[model samples]
Target: MIDPSENPELWDFLSSLHSGELLTGTIAAIEPFGVFVALDDGPDHPLFPGVGFITYPELSWTPFNEASEVLHVGQRVSCEFLQFDTWNGEARLSLRATRPDPFQLFADGIEVGQELQGRVTEILTFGVIVEVADGIEGLIHVSELAGTPCQGTQGVVRPGAYITVVVTGLDRQRRTVSLSQKRTSKGSP
Candidate 1:
């Protein structure tokens, strides 16, 4: 079989035709709606001026008001091709598609007895959600927070605090990561 990498142009064109293709290009223009890119320094033409997508500004609220603020001309970005309009032949893409997901990260990096530092994201009656890294979140059950029989998660830990925790166990089959903040701390519960 011929090597696909031998011809970059043939690869991009064929790859674009396939669903779930990841395309990377430099942003050529940014309007209120979306940002456009120039694929492999390709010519600016109506048929294909690279791939573009209009993202809701709320997706990245703090730094962006419109697409222009989020992406400037000549910015590099990677996106997944979501779908192709069979009739109009326009390609749809999403930036969020690049994220692998929290549970996957947890499964990859965690081991029993390993210590990790994370920010508390959510506190619930059952437990608190601690975010360790981008897309990696784990649950610290109320029972695991302290030795005492805690009534609520707040009594054990507060949100937005950077807390050190330990991985007690992992249910790989269920994709759940069990952690304990009390075990990691110096003092006893």
Candidate 2:
């Protein structure tokens, strides 16, 4: 078998790449899990069609139903090198890292006690997750779901249902925003 190390061209090309370097590539294929990119300035990957790969979450900051919604084959894209995935033998790339974080923008304009309308995206045993904006989700804990103590989240809220909630806490460091649905007549607390 021919060893990759024996190919000085491929070896030197791969050795020159470093994490956090910016790269340009064309979308070679779109998959459910990620997008394969044929790098314009890098050696061809032995296992994949392209030398760079972007995972689903790395495609964009906005939530998308399909990879095609964010990228198409032959499309040129700029990505940040996350790491060399030794297991997959591909360069782990992040397209979103090259763009501004939407969560940080959302957090900047929001404050505690501010009211916002959102759709329930998920219901967990501990709380209900609401999408206040594109890709922005906040949790309404079971205790904050109602004025009175509740037994469970089943009857409280369902997925796809729209609800108004007041922000109770914000942890920018953790990228978490705590919301509450319970409100008194005056909306003081």
Candidate 3:
């Protein structure tokens, strides 16, 4: 929804950009939620200092603890236009779109049933998250947790514990990986 309070002309300017079109800008501000970019060719924002924005997930392909770890204010960057932020009246850009997807690279060499060792990054009631490759995490569903019918994952695993898992599924369309711990063993991190 386009914010009625914002300038309509600004929205028009942003709508002119095509998705995946490369846009160059300098980091104008860094907020907890995302970064603001001062696009080289854009109107000055009515409310903000810049008319370009990059959300945290669009900033990088590699996982990080914070946006500061990957970007900083005043840093120049080239980002692919993702869409127009009608509500915010800014250009939504993706810095990661300018780079190759790491998940695709990891999937190129692997297939189903391949056994890989990775650290258990998270454990949920529904599944366990294992980091099988850089920026890639596979979900081991609760049903696939153990060989024998399992009770729960309460004391089964903890974060940072290395475990071996079989690649049960690869969803290229969604860019997701699914693993199973049923026929595997716990290993060292």
- TM-score: which candidate is best? 2
Q: Compose the digit string of candidate 1's lDDT tens values, residues 164-185.
A: 8888888867766778887885
Error of 2 at 91 (Å): 2.7
Which sections of candidate 3 miss by over 4 Å? 1-15, 184-189
Locate the minimum summed-lDDT window of 10 residues in model 2: 180-189
lDDT per residue, candidate 2, 85-138, as tens digits?
655556779999999998999999998889998899999998899999888999
Per-residue lDDT of 55-125 in model 3, one digit per residue for the tens? Answer: 99999988888888998889999999999877788899999999989899899988998999888999898
Off by over 4 Å in 1: 1-16, 20-24, 28-51, 54-71, 78-80, 94-106, 168-176, 182-189
For candidate 2, the clash count comes to 0
Residue pairs with backbone atoms closer than 3 Å in model 2 (clashes):
none
lDDT (C-alpha) at residue 47 in model 3: 81
Question: What CA RMSD would you report for each candidate?
Answer: 8.2, 3.1, 3.5
